[model samples]
Target chain A: MKYTVIVKPKKAILDPQGKAIKKVAENYFGKDIGDIRVGKYFEIESSEPKETIEELANKILSNDVTEDYEVIES
Target chain B: MKVAIIRFLGTNCDYDCKYACDVLGIKSEFVWHEETSLKGFDCVILPGGFSYGDYLRSGVLAKFSPIMNAVREFANKGGYVMGICNGFQILTESRLLPGVLLKNNNLRFIHKDVYLKTEGSRCYFLKDSNKNLLKMPIAHGEGNYFCTKEQLEYLKDNDMIVLRYASEDGSVDEDANPNGSVFNIAGICNEKGNVFGLMPHPERAVGHLGIDGEEIWKSLLE
Candidate 1:
């Protein structure tokens, strides 16, 4: 089975890259533009069990202190 | 005492660290990352560089090197271990130290000389120093340090915070914070104080560069 892992900075954490991009986006698309947050997406072609994949996402793909990750079967 | 300077795949400062050791009259050797043993070594220094190309994240992949197990064991056994710049990131990734280093708040790679105030630590590295302020060079993008609220309290209670960014007059404030580190922290030691990590390059500050870090090396050797 293939799995997709999406990692994003935690809500309480500040995303400077996202903020920098958001400023540029606002300059091009009006000041009312929505907030933009940066994140990492990974597609894995592994036959590992769901639990194993989850562990990979939790331990390797994302940092628990600053990032939140979700795994989806696709 | 002999110091073992561990060289990772992308480590560029191993030679610089060795030079510092040599200038200090301390015996040192370059140990490859794959080596599993740290026998006969009194201290270990992890120098700074773009290890593993800073892929995934700074020091993230480097933490999996075969020698980290031995480094962990050595640190756990009351051995002295110090990480500089990228080495600091690896220590945090390896869970040898608390907190994490994120990108600079301004989102830029900052490289310049900064003032550091000794905050007192249990470790011998910075203990009993006459100088309260020292100027050192820092070169890194992900030197912005952060931690949970509870972790900050624990660090304070244990005197784990060893260094903080300060002004020439030794004032630590938000304006003095170049990288937005919590409490303007530039360095920290583990709870036991055997392990320490800092974003500044003390090795780079010695010799021809500057002698501000000479006391740090002298105290560590003492």
Candidate 2:
């Protein structure tokens, strides 16, 4: 099975890289987007069960204090 | 005390740490990250560098190294463990320390000397200073420390905040914060005060310009 996980900084936390990207995009978009939040995507392939993959994603793939994660596809 | 500075695949600060220890009159050794045992060492140091190419995130991949288990065990036994720069990131990922290093507020790598003010505690890695103010160099991109407000409060209430960014005259304020770290924190210790992590490279500032990093190693004997 392959799991696609999306992780992003917690909403309350500051995302400098995301902000920088947003600034650049604005120069080209002409203020089409409101706020830009940057995040990372991970795809993990494993033969293990869903529970195991979920556990792995929770433990190693994301840090709860600063980032949030979700299993987008499995 | 014998210090074992663990060198991960991309660790570049191992020699600098070793040299700093030598300057403090202590013999140190560089141990590869694959070792499973840290039995005889009194202190373990994870030096700065682009460990594991800083792939997924700074310090993320390196935290899973085989040597980290031994480092954790050593820290659990009350042995001193210090992590600098990328090492600090690894420690936080391993959950040895709280919080995470976010991208710099300016979204750029900062490599310059800044003043550090030690909080009013006599930590093992601290305590031999002139009013606890010293100049140290910080070189990293993802060094903006982030944590929950409650966690920040807890760290402050417990004196876990070891060092913070400060002005040249040792005044800590918003203007002195180089990386937007909460509470201007540049370094912190675990609740037990055994494990330590800092974003600045004390080893890099040891032998040159003002020579403040030596006081940290010299405090090991105190």
Candidate 3:
């Protein structure tokens, strides 16, 4: 089995890297752009159950205080 | 006091910490991350570096090291534990300390000497320090600390905040905040004041690179 996990900074927290990239993107495209948020994507292949994958996403992949994680079974 | 400096893969500051201990006449030794016991050590120091190459996040991977279990047990037993720079990140990641360190507001790695205003009343690590304002070097990209508003209030209410970025005259304000840390926090102690973590490299200061970190390292003495 393979799992995909996506981790992103919480909505309330300021994402400085995303903001910097947004600025450059707007300059290059020369158009008003909506908010740009950056996140991490990870793919894991394991025989572990989905619960274990969720736990990994929650415990190691993302910081609860600053980020959120979603585990997708594949 | 005997100090055990915890060394994780890519931890480059362990030697500097050992040197600091030697200069202070404090017995110190390097304990690899695989060691499972923290026995016979009065203090544990986690020095700064890009542990695990900061793969997932700074200090995130290092938290799973075998030695961390010993560190947690030691800290829970009320033994003195201190984390500096990247070590600070690890403490937070390990949930030994509250909050998290985010990337700098400017999205840049900051390396420089900054003034610190000591503020905690219950920190064992600052008990012997006489200076309220001191200059120390900080080098990190993700040193901007953040926590929920409720947690921040609790930290303030409990006097857990140990240090804040400040001006030379000891005024703490937004201008002095290098990485946009909440309330300009540069260091904090656990609720019991035994476990302390800070973004600045106090060991590097001890009059070697520049400035005297005596206020910090000296306070660890028995």
The best candidate by lDDT is 3
Model 2: DockQ vs. true structure: 0.79
State the lDDT at B29 in candidate 2: 86
CA shift at B134, candidate 3, in angstroms? 0.9
Q: B1-222, model 2: which lDDT tens digit per residue?
A: 889999999999999998888777886888999999998889999999999898877898888889998988888888899999998999999999999998899988999999999896535688565558878899999999988889899888888999999999889999999989998999999888888899988887776534888767776653
Candidate 2 fraction of reference contacts recovered = 0.77
In model 2, which regions exceed 4 Å deviation? none
Consecutive 10-residue window with the lowest summed lDDT within model 2 chain B: B121-130
In model 2, pairs of residues that clash are: none
What is the C-alpha lDDT profile of model 1 across A1-74, one tens digit per residue? Answer: 88999999999899999999999998988784877889999999998888898999988888888999999998
Could you give candidate 3's per-residue lDDT for residues B42-68 as a string of tens digits?
Answer: 999999999999999899999999999
The alpha-carbon deviation from the true structure for residue B126 of candidate 2, after best TM-score superposition, in angstroms, is 0.6
lDDT tens digits by residue: candidate 2, A1-74? 88888888888987777788888888898885768888889888878777886787788888888888888555
- The residue pairs that clash in candidate 3, if any, are none
